[model samples]
Target: MRFLETDEHDDPILSVVNLVDLFLVVIAVLMIVIVSNPLNPFSDKSVVVIENPGQADMRMLVKDGEELREYESSGEIGEGEGIKAGVAYRLADGRMVYVPEAPAGGASGGAASADGAAQ
Candidate 1:
């Protein structure tokens, strides 16, 4: 039949089908990006994201459970209510080590060094 022999390129429905396929590919890619994002709302895992690290205009986004919180720095050294719980010192090789203070009454029995030796 002549219809069977006609050029498919002249058919408008073929173009629509191709357009739909292109849209489907675009939608799939967008979904993948959204799902892979650490801040996705549907995800249950807690996530912390820092922006502009070490810069004055730094910001932080913390996501816990279903809640999200944002913090912006004022570019000054942070001063807050917190107690000194540990000490850190740089070694000769430039590596830093931390030593936590023993709890009151020596609840931990003794302080352990980085090499697990009692101090």
Candidate 2:
């Protein structure tokens, strides 16, 4: 067991493990920086961005378009409001579905023959 740990104080394998650990930490920190940046592809200020990806700290950012609205970190359960556009159902063929938004009772009126067929 001791040999596996290190043959001496300056073991090359041990140094490699330490270097790998350092690199891992650096990668983790870089990931955090990228996610926190506003220009990041996955950065969403409106919705909650988990503080540490998985470790939620009850902190959130509310964005309105390009505007950076606010940050809430009360560390308490919160609720938000938004207009529900529509629903979606997925097929069994590994495809996605997205139902479009429409006004209430709009289906019949929208398809009632715009050319005035009844006339």
Count backbone overlaps in model 1: 0
Displacement of residue 26 (Cα, Å) in model 1 is 0.2
Writing each residue's lDDT as its tens digit, candidate 1 over 1-119 gives 98679787898999999999999999999999999999999999999999999998999999997999999999878678978888877768865567787777876444455565665
CA displacement after TM-score superposition, residue 45 of candidate 1 (Å)? 0.5
lDDT of candidate 2 over 67-108, digit per residue (tens): 554454555576899788765555577544555567777762
As for candidate 1, its clashing pairs are none
* Residue 80 CA displacement from its true place in model 2, Å: 39
Q: lDDT scores for all predictions?
A: 0.86, 0.59
Segments of candidate 1 deviating more than 4 angstroms:
1-5, 80-87, 93-111
Badly placed stretches (over 4 Å) of model 2 are 1-6, 44-119
RMSD of each: 4.4, 12.4
lDDT for 14 in candidate 2 is 82
